[model samples]
Target: MGKTTVIHHAPLVGYPDDKLYTVRVIDGVIDGIEEEVEGKYINGYDKASVEEIDLAGKEWLSPSMIDWHVHTKLAALHSNRLNLSNCQSASEVFESVKQALNDPKYDTSLERNLVGINMRNSNWTDEDLFSLEKMNELSIERPIFLLYNGYHSMWCNSLALEVGGYGSSLNHKGHLVEQEAFDMFPKLTTANNQVVDNWILQESKKAAAMGVTEIVDLEMEHNIVQWQRRYAAGNDYLRIHVGMYTPHIQDAIDLGLTSGDDVPHTDGLIKIGPYKIVTDGSLGSQTAFCHDAYPGTKDNHGIYYYPPESLSEMIETGLKHNFKFAVHAIGDYANHLTLQTISKASSKPRIGSTIEHAQLLDIEKDLPIFKDLGLIASIQPSHLVDDRDLCHKFWPGREHRAYAFKSIVDAGIPIKLGSDAPIAPMNPWEAMAVCITRAGQGDEKNPFIEAEILDLETAWKASTSNGKTRLEVGDRADLCILQSDPLKLDAAGLRAMKVNGTMLGGRWTHKTF
Candidate 1:
């Protein structure tokens, strides 16, 4: 049977249609799909006939991706904070700070000084903060805040330190600054709440155009009021799940906003998610909670964001309030501790429990427990490609335990994929490309455990929640239309596939135009 109709050619139909042998869509929805074969164009039905379209040279079609780990607000604020992060040496950071001081957008009248620096793969030190002579010249002046690429650690300059009253108490390594220091920084924008709320809406729309349908907003600040107002004002366009930051557990408990509350959305606006807790620092920083020293480091094994007992107490608090725990555990020891703590805290498994950034694992020892505990390994595959070298350099002996995707699959643990945007591109195809190829299409060595290169189906599931009721037909038509089938295409081909358009609940959220 043959027929001609306008539609983006995809490998499989997203929904079941037995009566129709083929579907032809005009913009994104089904315009006319022929049920019978051996059909040629008979343009009589003006209302039902689809416009002609040719999509013979494309690949991989699926629903829009759900990047479970993205920070829309933080992503927007990143550009605002770029003055400091793009710096390599302390001098460069200072120069950017000076430039920002002169920028009209930034106000200099604020009492507390707060600035952020972005650090990349370059080496950084406390002295980098200031040359000895420079420090002497700028002694006790204004506050300066420094941020690394990973957003896990920060450096506070001396002048800023005294004003914040953390003068000597803060560690010189620049890794010990707290939220008080973060707050001392100038706000990104001074507009009213509605203006900032509009900012979030604009960012969300941009994410939709990028093929991102869902994002896990892990903001600690309770801008929920802003979201509530914006949502009430008919500004909802994306599916947003928010992680209650670790520090704000008490506020969440006090507000009585328990986990799983379906908040307002102009179109299914907001969904409450897991309670976020940081178990340890990252591996590259040599601050991840590892049992062993980072190869040649002195006696340091990494710092815990909170004491073990405190972590357990926090998990218990979330468990009591019925909030799903989504703890960040990067190192083997940290992952082990987090698993043990959650197991000890709850007798029954929590449905939405997840371990964010399960970057490293003690495969033989830890994989089995994930299945036993029924936790979600919410991970970012792109990080493996970016951090492969660091994993090899800093974690020479533990290469086998790094990003062991196959091992997790073998252990029957359900793993969800995300890009952790602002850190990585928010594109799921790129991530799926990396997941299958293991070789980061850029310059990184392949981190794939060959045996663990997940099949395209699994990778697709990780990209978009494939097995759940949420993805079923008639739930919401939030999906992406791709030019080709992902599974049929090779790794490079998949990465190159074009996202033709996006739909959010049968509405065009993003179009080529």
Candidate 2:
């Protein structure tokens, strides 16, 4: 028989308050759960072979969380990049880069490029927007690449553009959007395997510390080989689902790889996730393919990365290859067109497909269609914290329908929460806080679209594995031990809740006990 491990006096979140719970596990699966009367005298497990942990009612236990949408590779790359999120204008960004160049840590040699990330130009005035001439003024010898906060645009200097094979005349402003930026991303951020692996390892440990047991890494590159290499190097803190893009679909099909197929040599730690396709741009980039133009523009309905027919063809092909689809749709028109494409595909996806970031929806129309289509909504609530002002500025008069979490739940659509890491922090607690309060971090007084705020229970469920609210028998032993009861906490308390330990398959990935 497998060794029995018993956890005693656990305060299970969302469970009965008057009773203490004892859970037993065998072979990394929950075997049984027993309720004990509060204050009852109980003896510890005395069996010679039994492993025991007595929480003594000092910790709250619940299912570990899952980040359904994240760009793991990009997150790792951004870990060391110069942060430009705090820069308010193009001049500030250039000044910050100039200062970083003087710092000994940043490399400015001709062979290497200086990279900065999280630049937001959505709220910047036209005069403050980045220009190629200004970028070239910094240095002609050193290449500079600045990634926007939304990951949909990049601002590069003349040398960087030359390195990326783009002529200066092609984009005088040095700004690349959508496919243009995506194509040049890896070229500028390429690093040795060992370096990237170390970065990913550090980021994985950070996720484990935050009680994240699983993540769907939707990095905009073919990730299987990279993940396999990482797993071989003992970087296995979290179970990862590696999502692929449309460009790699033919290769995946030719290799007979399907969605949910486990990569060899990883012991099920990594699996092929979905066939991801970006149908539109992002709100912060002012290119989300909205139904209406920006408040000041006429006949400008944003950009569509893929037309409806092209998207339909890709979905049909993916369905034939047994791949689940994850369509990136932010604006209402993008979501509407994605739904239409999926519904009209030649074949239906056998497994459940997901809409990545169904951010702005014609809620009254798309909610029912989304539910009827049996598609899951993979959302990153922390995006609202960042995009709140952008939504107000670019998408005025449609605030009520943006990031409508409560409405999605009420319509019976399965909603999963993530951080879209590197764009936002990969913290489930922060996501939950934002979802429950409809406010940004540390600023609950100014709630945006309060009518769409989710209840605490709904937000908690969205953050957990398979939306499980409580630990139960027959469940996997992926658990998170918390310093306090999340059920009794407000938004501030939830964001500040400390994690005592994290477990995966009965093994402690992180522990303070």
Best by TM-score: 2
Cα lDDT tens digits, model 1, 1-513, are 222234333334333322223334333244444433444433353534444433432432356778878766666555445445445566776677667666665554532344564455434454344432353343346555556656665555566555455556654433433344345433423345665566677777777766667777766566455466767876666777767876665665676776767654434457776788877888656678887887767878887677768987787777788888778899888998878777776564588688888888888777777778889888888888767767877788777788887778878998888877666657777888777767777532454566667767787777773433123333445666666556666677767867766766556677663
Cα-lDDT of candidate 1: 0.64
Q: Write the per-residue lDDT of candidate 2 for residues 1-513, one digit (tens) a residue.
A: 676777889889889866678878778788878886654323454467777788888898899999998899889888778999987777788889999887777764322788899987656665355688888888888889988888888888999999899886776579888888888878876577788889899999999999989999999887888899999999889999889887777767777788888877899889888889888999987789999997788987778877778887888888778898888999999999888878787766655688999999998888888887888899999889888888888998998899988899999998889988989989999999998889987689889988888998888888887578898889988899999888888998988989988888878889897
**Poorest 10 consecutive residues of model 2 by lDDT?**
37-46
Estimate the Cα RMSD of every predicted model relative to the unseen true structure.
5.6, 2.3
TM-score of 1: 0.79
Those runs of model 1 whose alpha carbons end farther than 4 Å from true positions after fitting are 1-61, 83-117, 121-143, 162-198, 246-257, 264-267, 444-452, 465-475
